[model samples]
Target: SQQGEEDPQALSIQEGENATMNCSYKTSINNLQWYRQNSGRGLVHLILIRSNEREKHSGRLRVTLDTSKKSSSLLITASRAADTASYFCATVVNTIQGAQKLVFGQGTRLTINP
Candidate 1:
């Protein structure tokens, strides 16, 4: 079962504009992370926000977590054509044996047109 779901299934924007993606999850998690994947390539880690953290930033990327709402958002400022890709939100789910694994959202596809 998928733990996370992203909104705005698809997004299109002009280069230099900003792109925002939202995610909501069903279960309690140790941390939430965002990843970006270019077509035909593996996902690249963007940022990780722990359950205790409300917000975090790295470069032009910003992430926010709301444990009470069981939601999170990712903001990319001044997006470029190179940034065109699919973005996903993932949650760390703990198992019975004290192990954890990532469950990813459906993902948001962002397109940047020049």
Candidate 2:
């Protein structure tokens, strides 16, 4: 399956703490994208790192890619209740249709304890 596997199906953290999530994939992909969904809302693209990129950072988010291990990690520093959401790592797979599609994993539901 193209869907990547994200661990820590659920996470609970206090404000000002850090949250870390991991994702592992089985196949070769063009890129991996991290998206956040807030309580029944549509997903917001957090970041996307191509297979050739080793690491990327955006605001409080830090992402590291290890192609050798076929895995990636996302770290959220200085977390808050507003950061509570479901994070999904979607893999962009190249298909015969000449279109790259994103396959979402089950996701990790992160809750910030106030």
Candidate 3:
């Protein structure tokens, strides 16, 4: 499958600490988007990095993409308890019919302890 799989299915860290997660995929993609979902909530888009881009940042979040390795990583600096959520990496692939499909990973559950 072209879906990306995040490493360390679950992570725990103290508030104010940094949290990092990694994801790996099997196929080529146009872009990769990161989403965060609070427990029992809808997903919130975090960031997106195009195949030509190596890294991107938004507020306290940093994302790096390595197309050569078909992998990506997300870093959350100075995490807070409210940041506890499930993070997913979705890859956008172009189909032969000229449609873009978004494939999401299983997700990495992050817990920030107070």
TM-score of each prediction:
0.96, 0.95, 0.95
Question: After TM-score superposition, what is the CA distance of residue 53 in candidate 2 from its true location, in Å?
Answer: 1.6
Q: Name the top lDDT candidate.
A: 1
Candidate 1 per-residue lDDT over residues 1-111, each given as its tens digit: 689999989999999999999999999888999999999999999999999999999999999999999999999999999999999999988889998888999999999
lDDT of 3 by residue, 32-89 (tens): 9999999999999999999999999999999999999999999999999999999999
| TM-score attained by model 1 | 0.96
Each candidate's lDDT (Cα)?
Answer: 0.95, 0.92, 0.94
Per-residue lDDT of 73 in model 1: 97
What TM-score does model 3 achieve against the real structure? 0.95
Model 1 spans with C-alpha error above 4 angstroms: none
The TM-score ranking, best first, is 1, 2, 3
| Per-residue lDDT of model 2, residues 1-114, tens digit only | 646999989999999999999999988877899999999799999999999999999999999999899999999999989999999999987879998778888899999999
* lDDT score of residue 98 within candidate 3: 93
CA lDDT, candidate 2, residue 81: 90
Q: Candidate 2: deviation at residue 105, Å?
A: 1.1
